[model samples]
Target: MTILPDFRYIRPANVDEAVAALAGKPGAAIIAGATDLLPNLRRGLGEPSVLIDVSAVPALALVEETADGLRIGAGVKLAELALHPVVQRDFPVIVEGALAVAGPTHRAAATVGGNLCQDTRCHFYNQSEWWRSGNEYCLKYEGDRCHVAPKTARCFATYRGDLAPALMVLGAEAEVAGPKGRRKLPLAELFQDDGAAHLKLAADEVLVAVTVPNSAKGLVGSYAKIRIRDAIDFPLVGVAAALKRDGDKIGQIRVAITGSNPCPLPISTDGLEGQPWNEATARSLADRLNKTAKFQTTTTVGMRYRRRVLLASARRLVDDLWEKAV
Candidate 1:
């Protein structure tokens, strides 16, 4: 049986305490819902000397409605977000994405922050310590080269988070706290293209909350993904789209993709606004999605197959959302 390494546990009462606990500890990691972190720890993927529990931070568990939009605490459970009446009514896309996350049991314990900040995955990297040691490890951890693309000095692990794509499509902002104090930035800016260092957050920074803009409310949106299993498997490719229709023509639209690249990416919808919602336009959108998606041999699925499915999924989602729009 795989055993977790020993670590010191610290339960912080508030965000300040959490940040303080993590500030100078290079081997410290924040844990809200251990759904992702625990499994990785068991696999010997992380060697955190300290695990800071932030689940009891009351401010991080709130789901508040502001005049601008909604403020979702990072510690809020996925199940709670999926069932919240306001979220269900105004942001069904988020509900869909949250519900698509593992099974009900995982969602019951997984937090919004944990989902958004989950690690990147690759077939070669997520293995037992013995398995990885024999395989010479990958670039993501204590390794010299990326097994997926050894010719390049970059890791191609895919970010498989379901909520990030949905949130990105809605133009959400992330609130973060650190030794330097608190700050808010566009959620898209929180991630980079490199799998080894995907999140832009510093070791001491804590993701506090996420706020969706009021302008994104009332937009017809949908989230779809292809996963190996219906219940617990991570998505191979996920697509999210939000549309604003103006008399049968597209007024505005945003598309975001995950499980394809190191970070969730928004597909450019330029030249798509004011266009008729028809097959031709859908094809154009698909073409754009295919171009934007950068698939690699990260998951067990073939790269080409993932690319094709990403396009098809994006096309289908856009067409369906358009048809549903008033």
Candidate 2:
């Protein structure tokens, strides 16, 4: 067995304790579930001296409904949230997304916050430390150039999270606890389009919760992911398309795709804001934007194959939504 690194583990009972523990420790890794972090450690990819465990913070695990919307605690396990009736009834997009994530074995241990803020992955980066170093470091690590795109000055790694795209379509907000205090911001605000960094969240901050908006006037939302297997596989390309219709005309729409870029690629559909949910309208918008999306060969499939599947996935979403309305 590969020997694990030596580290000091600190379990914080509350958010304050967690943030305080991380106040000035640049080398401290925030632990929630440890589903993603531990594996990297064992492979010698990441080695933090201090592990600040946030799993025991009760406030982070609490979720409840509110007058404005639902407050989903950061620590809520994916499996628990997938089975919640409220999630099924009110936010089927979220439920469906959760159900389609990783697998039952992982969902039970992985968390909502961790899923949203998971590290970006690539074919060249996720390997035994020795193996990756043997290939020379990629743009994501402390490397000189990208193995995927040697001429490009920036990283080409992809963000493969499933929940953030779903949440973005639902207008979700993330509540973060940091050394400064607690605050909530639009979920989309957390992500940075740059793959090298990927997010703007401070290292000391612990994402505490995510809240979904309550706009029941005319709600119709859907999430669809294209992956290699029926289960236990990350999506090669995922799309979360949510739209509100007034009578038969679309009032608002959010189109976001995961497994395509460093962050959720917000498909521009402003022209469809007041149009009906028609195949022609959806296809037109998709056609204009689909080709513009840059898909690198870092995912489970090649760039040509991934891009083709993404277009087909977008069409399938519109067709499925139309079928439901009938």
Candidate 3:
């Protein structure tokens, strides 16, 4: 049986204590729900000597509606977020994404921050320790080469988080707390294109919350994804679309995707503004997404099949949301 490496567990009472713990410990990992981290730990993916638990930080558990839109504390549970009245009324897409994750029990224990900061995964990299050692390991963890792309120096592990695409398309921003104090940045900036080093957060930094702008309010949106199964499996490819209507035309639109690359990516909707919203337009947008997505052999699904399904799913979601808007 695979066993987790020994680690010291520290549960901080507040955000300040949490940040301090991380800054002081050289090999530290911030954990909320442990829904993702524990599984990875059992697989021997990480060997952090210290695990800082921030679930008790009251500041990280608030869900407030301000003039700016909504502020969701990073520690908010996925199940709670999915059932939040404001989220249900104003940001149904976020609710959809939250509910799509893993299973009901996972949602109950998983936090929004945990989902956002979850590690990237690949079939070759997420194997048992013995299995990985037998395969000589991959670039994401121990060895030198990326199993997905041996010719390239980059790791091709995919980020399969459901919330990222949904939150990103709505123009959300991430609030971070660190030794330098607090700062806010566009949520998309939190991630990079590299799988081995995907998150741009410093070792001492902590994700505090996520804020959705008032500009995203009143927009019609939808989230859709295809997975290997109906439950307890990460998405193979996911799509989220949010758009504003200008009478009979499009006012503004944004499309984001996950499980295709190391980072969740936004498909540019440039020049789409003020254009007629129709089936043809949806098809065009879908085609653009299919062309923009960079798929690798990171999952069991064939790249061609993933590409085809992404195109169809994006097209269908846009079409459905447009119909609802009309």
Candidate 4:
């Protein structure tokens, strides 16, 4: 049986304490829900010396409205976020993403912050240590080269989070606290293109909350994904769209995609605005997405199949948003 390594577990009373606890402790790892961390630890994917548990930090569990917008505490459970009346009414796109995560039992324990900060996934890297021992280790672990692309110097693990694209389209921001103090940055800025260094957050930092603008409340949004199963399976290709309407014409629109690349790719909607939403226009955009989607062989799902789903899902989302608007 796979066993977790011996480690120190620390629980801080507040954000300040949490940040202080991580100071000078380079080997310390943060844990909120442990839904993702524990599994990786069991597989010997990481060997941190200490664990800082922020699950019981009260401030991180709040979900409220502030002058900045809707504030979602990082510690809020995925199940609570998915079923909350406020989220269901104003930000259904977020609810859609939350509901799509794992199974009901998992959602009950998984946190929004943990979901956003989850590691990039790869078919080769996610296997058991015994299974991985059959071949050379990849770059994501302790390997010298990437198995997916040996000639390439970087890891190609795919980001499969369902909520990232949804939040990206909504223009969310992440609130982080660390030894350097608290700072906020665009949610999109938190992700990096390298699979081995997927999250840009420092080892000493903790993501405290996510803030969405009030402007997003009135926008028509949709989240869709293609997965092997309805439960527990990660997305093959997920797409999210948020469109703002000026009477009948589109005022602004944002489209974000995940499960296709190292980070969520936000499509340029430069020419899409000011055009009427119709089947013809959607077909044109769908064609463009088919050409632009960059697929990697990081999952069992074939790259060609994922490309097709990306195009089809984009078109379907456009059609769905159009149907909801008028």
lDDT of each: 0.93, 0.82, 0.92, 0.88
List model 3 lDDT by residue over 1-326, tens digit each: 47888999999999989999998787899999999999899988989999999998998999999887799999999999999999999999999999999999999999999999999999998889999999999988999998899999989899999999999999999999999999999999999999988899999999999999988986898999899888778999999999888888998889999999999988988888898987677777877897779999998889999998999898888878777876
Clashes of each: 0, 0, 0, 0
Itemize residue pairs with steric clashes in candidate 1: none
- Using lDDT as the measure, which candidate wins? 1
Kindly list the per-residue Cα lDDT of model 1 for residues 1-326, writing each as its tens digit.
Answer: 36888899999999999999997899999998999999999999998999999999999999999986899999999999999999999999999999999999999999999999999999888899999999888899989999888999998898999999899999999999999999999999999999998999999999999999999986889999899888788999999999999997999999999999999999889999999988888888888887878999998789999988888888889888988987
| TM-score of each model, paired residue for residue | 0.98, 0.95, 0.98, 0.96
Model 4, span 45-131: residue lDDT tens: 888899999997999999998998999999999999988888888999999999888899989999999999998899889988887
Ranked by lDDT from best down, the candidates are: 1, 3, 4, 2
- Evaluated at residue 90, the lDDT of candidate 4 is 92
Instruction: Evaluate candidate 3 by giving its C-alpha RMSD to the native, one decimal.
Output: 1.1
Per-residue lDDT of 117 in model 3 = 97
Model 4 spans with C-alpha error above 4 angstroms: 287-292
Model 3 vs. true fold: TM = 0.98
Superior candidate under TM-score, 1 versus 4: 1
